[model samples]
Target: MIRHLVLFKLNDGVGRDEPRVIAGAQAFRELDGLVPELEFWECGWNITDRPIAYDFAINSAVADGDALTRYIEHPAHQAAAGQWREFATWVIADYEF
Candidate 1:
């Protein structure tokens, strides 16, 4: 098994960033159908204080490294990530089983 976790800090330079973040979260949360290896999906805003925490984050579970790679390279993921470029300033990760 593999746990793929990511955190995102919104650029907030664009006026529409909040909505984009919400939409992106919704899209990613619904990716189980698009990627068969996806075991679980969760995303939300960060209202707590953590050393490296971002405004938004996602924690997903996959079958293995290959599934993780497939999830990252999938077209549906590509579209979701492309939207991040406009509103995201930083990303953090911690991937392990």
Candidate 2:
């Protein structure tokens, strides 16, 4: 399986309580139900206030690279990502397990 992890940092001055940010996070939270290629999905806002910590994170799994690709290309994922792009920047990593 492929473990896909993402760390998201909100842009300066963008708080997590903002409606747009809340909606964007909700969009990502909905992906597990909307994307069939996802074998696992977990996402949430960070509670830590440390300067090094990201504002949000997502941990997901899929069968393989192809499945991961399908998850990335899924319309729901795209919509969520598009919404996030307006207020945050993210970094991702994928590894096999």
Candidate 3:
């Protein structure tokens, strides 16, 4: 399986309560059922206030690298990610398990 992880940090002057952020998060939350390649999915805001912490995260898995690629290229995923492009920056990691 391939595990895909993402961490997002809002840009300076951006806040979680903003409409775009809320919609972006909602878009991610809805993807588990929308994307067929997802074997597992979880995402949410960071509860901790530590300086090293990211503001949001996504934990997801797929059958293999091909499935992972499909997930990444999926149109719904593209739109969700596009929302963040304007207000946040993110990092991602993928590994086989």
Off by over 4 Å in 2: none
On residues 64-92, what C-alpha lDDT tens digit does candidate 1 reach at each position?
Answer: 77887888899888888887777786554
Judging by lDDT, tell me the better candidate of 2 and 3.
3
lDDT of 3 by residue, 53-78 (tens): 99999999999988998999999999
Q: Ten-residue segment with the worst summed lDDT in candidate 2?
A: 29-38
Which lDDT values do the candidates have, in the order given?
Answer: 0.75, 0.95, 0.96
Tell me the spans in candidate 1 whose CA falls farther than 4 Å from its real position.
12-17, 49-52
The prediction achieving the highest lDDT against the true structure is 3
Q: Give the 10-residue window scoring lowest on summed lDDT in candidate 3.
A: 64-73
As a TM-score, model 3 comes out at 0.98
Which residue runs of candidate 3 sit more than 4 Å off their true CA positions? none
Give each model a TM-score. 0.77, 0.98, 0.98
lDDT of 1: 0.75
Cα distance off (Å), candidate 2, residue 55: 0.4
lDDT of 2: 0.95
lDDT tens digits by residue: candidate 2, 1-97: 9999999999999999999999999999999778999999999989989989999999999999999999999989999999999999999999999
